[model samples]
Target chain A: AQKVTQAQTEISVVEKEDVTLDCVYETRDTTYYLFWYKQPPSGELVFLIRRNSFDEQNEISGRYSWNFQKSTSSFNFTITASQVVDSAVYFCALSEGTYSSASKIIFGSGTRLSIRP
Target chain B: NAGVTQTPKFRILKIGQSMTLQCTQDMNHNYMYWYRQDPGMGLKLIYYSVGAGITDKGEVPNGYNVSRSTTEDFPLRLELAAPSQTSVYFCASRYTGTDNEQFFGPGTRLTVL
Candidate 1:
């Protein structure tokens, strides 16, 4: 079985503030994939980032960055200079990357981030 | 490309009523999935199909059913509408491979009373 935990249920910050959302995961498979999804008020989930277990290198896409630490089994996402548009429920997800579980994906409860102007 | 699309963007159902939620993708993805999102909760997988005719249940599959008769279409069915079944349903599809990015649909909001 696989599980994802987003400890922070909700967080609020003013615009331009940097916020980091933490994600922890548990999986029996030695290899797996981690993902972050954003669900805005519109109710549609938008895929933010996807990282495989093998690639521990951090990623930076404009204002968004992700830290994947295999040793700690944590994948954290950070939004620098967050804007009001970034306010949304962010979800951390996991999937078995090995052939053991195929492509079953599991999601965490989610963290509602609010960026006020 | 239309990516992924769902029908009846919103629907209201009476107790015990039945309906099917439609999902289609133009990307020719081999893996399709059905997930339901509740208020303040992450999306829960209900069912998935690797290809046409191959379907499997996911974490929360009690009140729903799904069928994948064609590569481009996967439909989810709710046999007996209940308030507990009310949620926002999302359809997603991904290419045939491990750890691939899944494209999501706009979602369908269903209310049961």
Candidate 2:
């Protein structure tokens, strides 16, 4: 079974400040995919990023970035100079792939981020 | 492209009543999923289909049922409504592959009184 854990239930930061969301996962599969999704107040989930176990390279997308570490089984997301629009619930998910449809994805509890101006 | 569409954005059902949540994807994806989000919690998978005519139970699939008769549609049905089943439901789909990203629908908010 694959399980994802997002320790922080809620986080608050002032606008333009930097914030990091922590995500740790547990999976026995040798190969799997990790994903980050954002759900704003509108209640629609927006796909943020996806990283696989083989690639631990850190990624930076404009104001958003992700650090994938295999040794520690952690995939953390960071926001640089976050704005009010960044306020949303962020989720970490894991999926095992073996070219079979039986492999299902699991999600964490989620971290609710509040950006205040 | 109307990526993933879910019908009945908001619904309220009485106890013992039943309803179906409709989901359709135009992306020609082979994988579709149904998930429910409770208060202060992440989404829990209810059911998923890898392709048409193939459906499987997910983590929390006890109260719900799903059928995939076509590649484009996956509908979730609640047999007997209960207060515990009241939550926001989201439908998503992804192409068959390891790196394919899952596209999500706006979501359906269901309330059972």
Candidate 3:
């Protein structure tokens, strides 16, 4: 079974400050997909990013970025110069493969981020 | 186009009552899923269907049932409502591909007393 763990339950940071949310996963499969999703106060799930096992390359999307490290089985997300709009609950998820019997994605407990002024 | 739509955004049910949560997707997705979100917790999959007439149980499928009679509609049924069953439910769909992303609906908030 694949399991995702987001150690930080909640985080607070001042506006325009940088913050990083940690995510660690456990999966026996050699290949799998990792994803990050954001749910704001409006209660809508928004897809942030998706990373596969083979591709450990870091990604930067405007003010958001992700670092995937296979050695530690970690996929961390960082927000640079975060604004008040960035306050939301972030979730880390894992899906094994397309052919896996249970292709259903499993998610972590989530990290609630609060951006203060 | 409405990627995914769930009806009855908010509902209240009494104990022993039953109701169905309607979900529909216009994106022609082959995989559809139902998930529930509890307080301070991540979403847990309740059920999923690969295609029409093919439904399977997910992590937490107790006290709930689902049916996929068409490619566009998947409805979730709660046989007997319980207080513990109160939570927000979300419907999502994904196309047939390895790198596919699941598009989610706004979600239905159900309260049982």
Candidate 4:
């Protein structure tokens, strides 16, 4: 069974503050893929990043960063200098990377981030 | 490129009514998926198709049916609309490759009453 857990239901922070969204996953598959998506007030899902199980290297894109730690089974996302535009719901997802079952992705409940100016 | 597109951005269905959520992708991807998201929640996969003819159920498929007659289109059908089936429906597609990153549609908001 593959599962993704995002314990923080909602978080509110002032603009320019740094916020981290925690994501923990449980998957027995040795080869799996993890992802983070952003859903803004517009209600469209935006793909943020995708990290494979083999790649534990952290990634940074502008103010958004992802920390993928295989040892902890966690893929945490952080927004540095969070801006009002960064306010959105973040979701963590897991997918079996094998050829047979790679089409399915299991998503976390989600974490809503509210940025206040 | 149109990426992925869904029809009827918003719809209201009465109990026991039926409708199909249409999805089309211009990318010619081999894998297509249908997922539903409840308010303030993550997405739950309802069905997926690896190709034009292969389709399978995902995590939540109780109230939905899907058909994949062509690689560019995958439509989800609701046989009998129920309140529990009301959610935002998203369609996605990805090339059959190592990345497995799915491109999503704008989504269809469905309400059942």
- Output the number of the lDDT-best candidate: 3
The residue-by-residue lDDT of candidate 3 on A7-91, one tens digit each, is 9999999999999999999999987889999999999999999887889999999999999999999999999999999999999
Q: What would you estimate as the lDDT of candidate 3?
A: 0.94
Positional deviation of B96 in candidate 4, in angstroms? 0.5
Q: Name the runs in model 4 displaced over 4 angstroms.
A: A99-101
* Per-residue C-alpha lDDT of model 1 across residues B1-113, encoded as one tens digit per residue: 99999998999999999999999999888899999998778899999998999999998999899999999999999998999998999999988653678889999999999
Cα lDDT for residue B63, candidate 1:
87
lDDT score for residue A69 of model 2: 93
A best-first ranking of the candidates according to their lDDT comes to: 3, 2, 4, 1
lDDT of 1 by residue, A1-117 (tens): 788999999999999999999999999877788999998888888899999888999999999999999999999999999999999999999988663344777999999999999
Calculate candidate 1's fnat.
Answer: 0.57
DockQ-based class of model 3:
medium
lDDT of 4 by residue, B2-100 (tens): 899999999999999999999999998989999999987899999999998899988898989999999889999999899999899999998876487
Clashes within 3 Å, all models in order = 0, 0, 0, 0
- Which lDDT tens digits does candidate 4 get at residues A1-117? 889999999999999999999999999989999999999999999999988888889999999999999989999999999999999999999998664554588999999999999
Give the per-prediction TM-score of chain B.
0.97, 0.97, 0.97, 0.98
Q: Evaluated with DockQ, which candidate comes out highest?
A: 4
DockQ, model 3, C-alpha based: 0.59
Could you give the DockQ of candidate 4? 0.65
Clashing pairs in 3: none
Model 3: per-residue lDDT, tens digit, B32-83? 9999999899999999999999999999999999999999999999998999
Q: Which 10 consecutive residues of model 4 chain A have the lowest summed lDDT?
A: A96-105
* Model 2 bad stretches (over 4 Å): A99-102
